[model samples]
Target: MQALEERDYFTDYEILKDPYAFFEAVRSHGPVYQPPGRDYLIVTGFAETLEVLKNSADFSAIIGVQGASAPLPFEPSGSDISEQVEAHRDRILGGDLLVNYDDDLHTKTRALLNRLFTPSRLKANERFIDEYSDEIARQMIARGGCELMRDVATPFVTLVIADLLGVPADDRQHFMNVIDAAPPPGSLNTEENDFRGENHPLTVMGGFFARYILERRANPREDILNEFAHSTYPDGSVPELEELVKMAAFLFGAGQDTSAKLLGNSIRYITDQPGLQDQLRADPSLIPQLLEEVLRLEGSTKQTARLARRDTRIGDRAVPAGTKILVALSAANRDGERWEEPNAFALNRPKIKEHLAFGRGKHVCAGAPLARVEVRIILEKFLAYTSNIDLDEAKHGPRGNRDLNYDPSFIVRGLTELHVKFTPAEGVDLSQASSQAETAQ
Candidate 1:
């Protein structure tokens, strides 16, 4: 393996777009390789990443709780980050939201948030996903082709989230417009400039929920938002409005952004491969399996940052306390040492569930179940309604010679846009049928 010194992986937007080569070059030095320019180490081994995830005592997600908006300076080699992080906790975090907490608080918060994404809620949303997906397919077929990012995936996922959150129909369009105008799902542009960082999409969403919570408190209604408003902390105290806003905002933004990326990646993969689309059309049951392969190969959130709470070892490398480690989920999933044919999209891969697309341990995505439902429904509808799906060479260039665009970010691995054509299936001409009926009348 070749070692590239201080590659500056984070700031280089072009390199970040296609970082597989970089990952391959550096994995040999991991489970704890420190890239130059940056002070942190990168955890590249599957087992090692798992160790860090499971042993939270030595690793804290407090840095993650601070997240992109309020990142602190990386402490020098021997210094502890715990103190620095704790000092600015309130100013940086405002208050403890789900991702910011650890131990008992994280446990209780997760339990409370679990009420919104329960199996029953998912089951109830199944019909809505199916109907909405079918509608989207019809729209795509009518257009002949679309920029899948804006036309299909983003709208589909956003609508699903709004419905699940009990946003009234009349208010849904405005909400989507607000989210669309904020920033692209995976872009780090906001992190770079802090432009409207306060009114960023997630914050805007939190603000919306904040008002709704007040209204629901006064005029209690039968909806998910109402239930969430009533949810209490583990100490049996009702959380303040601002806290609820953060919770609502986190769930909505995380759910919508990740699901959109997943759908875009899945479509790009299946459409690019020959015979895969037909294979999936023939047996829709294989979709769940295919989605697993997609996750393993192209996880939406590629990697996440964690701060080491205490000095520890990852593989043979000794990491000191306060060390910032980038857990490479994408690299770990493709570890040739752990997976046979790791890079290939093999639907029958036996250990598919081992993939960390949803992260691991306590911080696993809460909205995963709903995301799965949305993707499966949309794929099924797309395949059912289209005879053939192919990339719009005019929009995205020729099949093998296209400029593949990805969101330039350290964490989000997703296409910026996917333009594709869909040939309507035989006997499936809703538009034509409507025209014929109009003529007959």
Candidate 2:
């Protein structure tokens, strides 16, 4: 086997599949280490990664969506490449994305996003989310087995965001179809920046949202869509129509894959350890804490890329302008310096929410709140609706020798599919369990 330094994190499918080992090896060098022959710096230390993520002025989020493997369009000349970034912003992949927005634009745009996650809106949608979770959990339990992503996470997460976004009920299936048909953005198999094409979720969904926003503006409705349609920045300026479409489309895209991945990752863990499964099933309240531990250990996003817009230093390391820094969220979350027994899953882990799974600073995931609720509720229902959950040993061999497939992408860590067997709870009514679940909410 080649040395750890010889691995290509972005292109190496093996590394992309199971990167914790590589991250562990990298951590031996220190929190932030530039691997041999690689132009980018890998930040695996929680503190070092946060320091970089927090200093947005020094680091441009222009590369946030794109993996660090993707090269920039221009070369660095001066100590500050802010002007270069602005000039060539269009050339950078995913520049127009909300995650890549910076300073004033980011602040104002995020203001509009905040409307979608308001307390009242989420509270109001609680019924729909619970109902949806109950239905999917029952379906999986009745069948005795499911390809977790296809049978559960994908459809569950897609429609949760759909209902919240108020996509017309009649057309919800079409939106799900469009999203399902396309491979997620920035998959490892595709060329960098090639994931968005004619059928891309953002493209197709943006087209629909544009029409919806325009129509809602012309003919108002008493719904979240209407609020989103009329939303204005804190500075009292309305964002352009294209901006609204991008924001809405981004909400769906981001919410779907990451949330689904989290749900699937959580279930995988639950199935792996029978004790953990029984432990969680015994107390459904522990489900939320379980989700936090899952997010920390196996978050959907592995690492996020940031470009150094100005010469800066992350602790003792000197970073010049135009450098790509890969903040390893997965690695950082498990940094031994930050957590006790980092590799172990502990639902009672202290300061659990402090993990970088959803990232930190300004670019923290806006849909994190929804993701938390979505996955937690789904797990609760799954546990209540089922007597037992276990991996389909035929498809995914025995514990030590498993055959699981993960998405071939460097940016996001997710399973391509997770096949699992489940048994429905005997003498337990889904309706009663669902009602109780909703009551606790």
Candidate 3:
């Protein structure tokens, strides 16, 4: 009914307000689409999205530059950006993180990461996750209600990640403040803040981590940061301090930010739907499935950018080298051909764990396992302490029919704020809850 440009999804505020229908419209058109005036190709179908992700040789992720976690806008510059990108990528040790590398280099970097995220460290971190989740839930219940994003999800995620990375308790508040001040990844605000001198959250975070990296080297500890400080590539070459700082800072931001979005969205969804909330509280074991359904139906990450290295055909469309392609992870997760009643959030949905919420192939999210553990613990703690959860209609709109307000950005799908009220279970006390949490563990 409308022209393609008329339905411009990314920049159009109205479409972004409720993006699923627009995503479905894009999928219905074809697997690969080049919208009017936009040079980049959008891969929407599940199969097509997989093809691009799996075959990095055909579609290179080496976009010639790096910064925050968001994808750069797809507009082509006449001059080659490769040289500048090369300089950035080649700036050894922590200079180029996981996302910037491909092929052999990507593999090597990933191997080093694997060393850092050992199974034992992850298991040990679960104790801290439980402690952080319980403390945050206690505060939320005491407040009676809160803007879930700011009060609970954000701080909960930030603390767990900080503890995991061995960030000092005294400095934890500063780290939280820094992350809060930083704009969501890929936002223009990052650039504006950087231009204003010394205020950019990423820059501050980089400096903090850089100092910590040096400290960890001088006085090694049993934390992951120390592991990174002492790590070497397969060839036994040590990464530069700058390189280590860049990677650690990126992880700190990316880890907390995306998990907060996921946890907030999951809690808001269940709380908004009373039946689902009750179902989950009655049988708390269902939370893992509930989270999987959340990931499938509405994931935090929506899209990723890739460049075509050579002539490539996705379905029927032929793409030339250097063409930037937008792989729609959100759209692919809802493809009807692959998922039954794909739009419905079914807790028992079969094979739902296979969803592409965390991209596919080599560049899949490194923090996915940690994110799962964090959200799962938060949900469990909330259920243990609260009898009921409901929307704070006075602050957010009408009680039963309020629309969920989401951030107006293509890179991350999350709420700007989610006000909610929690009803504590009868006879529930913070001390008792903490004891029960320990016993359960």
* Per-residue alpha-carbon lDDT of candidate 3 for residues 1-441, written as tens digits (9 for 90 to 100): 775333766567656555677777777778787776676777779988888888877776764222223344443343344433344444422225577677777887777666646678789999988876787787677668888887777777887778788877777778888778666754434443332237755567888888888898899997788888898988888877776776777778888888999998798778766589778878888898998889877888877777775667787787766577877788899899899998877888998788898888998888888899899988887888888887888877765678677876566778888888889888888653443222222
Segments in model 2 whose C-alpha atoms lie over 4 Å from true places:
191-196, 430-441
All candidates: TM-score: 0.91, 0.95, 0.89
The Cα error of candidate 2 at residue 258, in Å, is: 0.5
How high is the CA lDDT of each candidate model?
0.76, 0.85, 0.74
Local accuracy of candidate 1 as per-residue lDDT tens digits, 1-441? 324535756666766797777777678665567776566777778898887777777777775633332345544345455665565555543235577566676787788788888889988888788777777777778778888888777778888988898977766776667666655543556463232267676676776788899999998999999998887887898877876787787787768889999999999888887789999999999999989999999988777767776777777777778777788789888998888988777878997988888888898888888888899999998898888999888777876677779988777888888998989889886453322112111
Model 2 agreement with the true structure over 1-441: per-residue lDDT tens digits: 878855888888789888999989888999888889899999999999999989988999998877787788888889999999888878877798888988888988998898889888888878898887887676667668888887778888888898899988767777777766666656765743353566677888899999999999999998888999998899888889999998899889878989989998998889886588788878888888898999999999999999998899998999999889988999999999999999998889999989999999999998999999989898898888778888888899997687888877787788889998988888865443433222221
User: How does candidate 1 fare on TM-score?
Assistant: 0.91
Candidate closer to the true structure by lDDT (higher is better), 1 or 3: 1
Which lDDT value does model 3 have at 89? 46
Query: Candidate 3: where are CA atoms >4 Å away?
Result: 1-6, 64-95, 188-197, 431-441
For candidate 1, give the lDDT of residue 108: 79
The numbered model that scores best in lDDT is 2
**Candidate 2, poorest ten consecutive residues by summed lDDT:** 432-441
Report the Cα lDDT for candidate 2: 0.85
> Which is better, 2 or 3, measured by TM-score?
2
Clashes of 3: 4
State how far residue 380 of model 3 sits from its true place (Å): 0.7
